[model samples]
Target: MSELFENYLACWNETDPTARRALIERHWSEDATYVDPLADVRGHEALDATIGAVQAQFPGFVFTPAGPVDAHHRQARFTWGLGPAGAEPLIVGFDVVVTGTDGRIETVLGFLDRGPG
Candidate 1:
């Protein structure tokens, strides 16, 4: 489960479109959906684009796990922090992920725990 969350954060950190898309394809279901306070999107293309947008908006920042992942029965929850290397996080979030029967992410429900005003 931790590896899954690590891959999830890696997807957010990857800037190369090809690499990111590959990560998404390997870890996420084709019809996966993601919803958060600011965005709601479904499918691989939209997910890729959304991640790209975040990368563009916060260039050089990286996403890291804030704590251990807790998972049970194909569901997992974790917290994440985003910021420049060696600096305190500027944005923090929590996400709950549901994996499909194939063990790929089927859906993600996200919440912003801390963000710029």
Candidate 2:
């Protein structure tokens, strides 16, 4: 479960499109959907583009796990923090993910716990 979150954050932190795409392919299902307060997207392409947009918006920010992940029955929820390295997080979020039988992410429902507003 921690590995899943680690890979998910790695996808967000990776600037190279090729590396990020590989992470997405390995961690997420082909038809995965992600919905948050600000964006809703489906499939690998949209997910990749959305992640790139976030990286562009906050050039040096990195996403990291903020708390322990709790998972059961192919579903998991975790908290995350986003900010410059070694600084307090500027954004905090919670996400619930559902995994397919094959153990890849199938859907992600996200919420903003805190933001830069």
Q: Which residue pairs does candidate 1 place in steric collision? A: none
The per-model lDDT (C-alpha) reads 0.94, 0.93
Report lDDT (Cα) of residue 59, candidate 2: 91
Per-residue lDDT of 13-94 in model 1, one digit per residue for the tens?
9999999999999999999999999889999999999999999999999998898899999999999999997788999999
Task: At residue 63, give the lDDT of candidate 2.
Answer: 94
Reference-based TM-score of each model:
0.97, 0.97
Q: Which stretches of candidate 2 lie over 4 Å from their true place?
A: none
Candidate 2 has a TM-score of 0.97
Compose the digit string of candidate 2's lDDT tens values, residues 1-117.
887888778988999999999999999999999999989999999999999999999999999899999998999999999999989999999999999999899999999999996
